[model samples]
Target: MYYDLMQTGLVGELLITGDNDGLKKVCLIKGKNDFIIPSDWIRDEVLFSDVKEQLGQYFKGNLKEFDIRLTPEGTCFQKLVWDALTEIPLGTTVTYADIAKMIGRPKAERAVGGAIGANPILIIIPCHRVIGSSGKLTGFSSGLENKVLLLEHEGMEIKGSERSALVM
Candidate 1:
């Protein structure tokens, strides 16, 4: 089943997916307010007895790492991108091209963007770390403002405060 762990700042969401076998995926998101169950936002079974309690702890700025297991279902490249995101240290950021290079696709920046947008899991995957070549924050299904806020919260520096605006 899939479940969510909302961050304390109300600016991030973590999608946790798992099954009878065990946990599988953990996606982190920023500036996303939607938590509906009917849509694709969530498809796995979710009914954790302590979900609300745990979420409260998260919202209170008391929790760091999550305790839920998620099974993110996606393609190999997509998974690779997501995995790379996890490697990004907390309070740090990386560019989409950096992710492509990490995956041995230095020229597949566009492809990396596509995978990032398709990331259903959000915050846990840390797609917010990917930015424009000019070092400006960019595309995010959850909204760019939220993305910026997430970076700020993590203490990650954002360059080009003016010139480099979001294009995607």
Candidate 2:
């Protein structure tokens, strides 16, 4: 597999990995704010044009779900949780407990949260849609601020959590 990096106005740095088949991972760089592309990685803008376009549209609220192919690697349970994340509609929120129930593990809210954290594909998988049961904003691999920005871009009003209460 090879990797490429791109900087965006909304999500900062994104590390995209792929092979001959399709996209493997799209990780957001949350620390140091830089992507260190491996020596073997090929930096090809043509290979990631679609990804950039779709993400730009998403940030502008013109797109709801991504159409790019994905090949995220994870355990079976993690894959299950990530798949369930795709089912979460835009402009709405669901709790980790809700995902637990969806995966037939009603008492595995914590487990579901862990799986969500392991999601390799960030905004495309919609992990940001998961929140606390009390409608509070929870952890986001890309950071809570980006999570709030994403939710707001989707036109969802932040109503429950002070953490999401932007003074604007």
Candidate 3:
């Protein structure tokens, strides 16, 4: 396994941990915080250059979509939720209840949110696109500010803590 940490201009630090087979996790690094890199993990810029480039482009609003291979570890339901997240088009948002219905568990909105929170891959998995049923920006593992920034970066219309929606 290997890992590389990348810091974007707006999104801050990102910890990308993975193996040769595929990516395992990509987490946002909070302020001034440090993480223990495994002894076996070697820092390789080349290994994650594409992700860095894509994320950079995304932050700049030059890229609306991502084309990267990811292998996030989670339970079957979580995997299903994560996969469904990818189907959410750029510049659009969906509610947790919507995801629950998509997965044939309309009564499992809270469970869907739980799965969303467990998503190891952030922007690549599009978990930020999920919002509250009332159209308000909800909890984001990466933080509300970052989530708002990301939604703005994607051209999604966001109002002052009161509403969240796509422009088109």
Best by TM-score: 3
Instruction: Name the candidate, 2 or 3, with the larger TM-score value.
Output: 3
| Candidate 3 residue runs with Cα over 4 Å from true position | 162-168
RMSD of 2: 2.7
- RMSD of model 1 against the true structure: 5.2
TM-score computed on alpha carbons, candidate 3: 0.90
lDDT of 1 at 155: 63
Model 2: CA > 4 A from native: 30-34, 159-168
Predictions ranked by TM-score, top down? 3, 2, 1
Across residues 59-100, which tens digit of lDDT does each residue of candidate 3 receive? 777887788888888999999999899899888999998999
- Residue 91 CA displacement from its true place in model 1, Å: 1.4
Worst 10 residues of 1 by lDDT: 29-38
lDDT (10s digit) by residue, model 2, range 2-50 = 7777776776778888776777788887667355667777777777778
In order of lDDT, best first, we have 3, 2, 1
Q: Which is the better candidate, 1 or 2, if ranked by lDDT?
A: 2
The predictions' CA RMSDs to the true structure, in order, are 5.2, 2.7, 2.3
